[model samples]
Target: MVSTALQDLFGGKAAEAVLLALFHHGEAYGRSIARDFAVSLDSVQRQLDRFERSGTLVCKRQGRTLVYTWNSKSRLASRLRDLTGVVYDGLDPQTKEQLFAERRQPRAKDKPVIRR
Candidate 1:
């Protein structure tokens, strides 16, 4: 099971999930993050709204999805990312596996696939 350390530190599950998702993926949207982390959509969205309002995050529209990412322009952006890294690195291996399960986006038309 994923540890509750992040949730305790962040004060809520949704906030922990949002920060970790963005930290892991570089960007996130409500539905995707919630689905990935088992957080409720409403909870994830509310945390997104709060972060955006606090200048900790920014939002942009990509097609129909409202994507959120860390606000690079914010003075605390780097610090926040570093803190996320610290938290992530502290997680148990099993928790890390559960948290970072695959969720790939579709490739653009005619885009080349890169096999690892």
Candidate 2:
């Protein structure tokens, strides 16, 4: 998987996943990120914590959830985002599609199907 190459380069799969999520979505909480990648919450939280501690990311509490985003002040932030963008672009079409398949709304009840 192209993502595995990112994992190898970034140290851990969880960290890579978190980075990609942040790069693609701008900000996200640990659980949502884990759910997106089908990874363990603990692993995602661990990577989030590590990035926060290292100043690679920053978090702000929003109601009950802590939303994490890239630390723009960090010297490495832009470079890292660029690298992740390259990796994201290299991903296979199906994986790229799944990465952004999160639903933003529910289908209308009893709606009729439309075919092209």
Candidate 3:
């Protein structure tokens, strides 16, 4: 997991984590963000609400899910994105890899693993 520097800067760990996830992963729902960080869903949802209220993010319903994305029109959006990029760049290799890892690939059913 990334460090708490974001929490220090943003004043809330859940908000920081949610912002990082959205900034890196693009449109995500609260549960996915919570799952990604292994945090409480309620906390993530609250932060999402806060971001929406503050105009830092925007949300729309996609089926039953409420998807969130950066508000590109918001004046602070670009600055925050740049800050996230800077923070991501300065992270240690392992944390950086984890932060940007691809986790949405399709899997075949009943597939067996092959060992090297």
Minimal lDDT window, size 10, model 2: 107-116
Report the lDDT tens digits of candidate 2 across residue range 13-73.
Answer: 7888898888777898999888888889999999999989988899999999999988999
List of clashing residue pairs for candidate 1: none
TM-score of each: 0.82, 0.82, 0.81
**Shift in Å, residue 34, candidate 3:** 0.4
Name the top lDDT candidate. 1
lDDT of 1 by residue, 1-95 (tens): 36556688778989889988888779999998899889899999999999899898999999999999999899887787888888877776666
Q: How many clashing residue pairs appear in each of the predictions shown?
A: 0, 0, 0
Q: Which ten residues in a row have the lowest lDDT in candidate 1?
A: 107-116
Candidate 2, which segments miss by more than 4 Å at Cα? 104-116
Candidate 1 TM-score, C-alpha based: 0.82
Summarize candidate 3's per-residue lDDT along 1-116 as a digit string, tens digits: 65666788878769778877876667789988887787899999988898899888999999999999999899887788788767655666666456555564454664322111
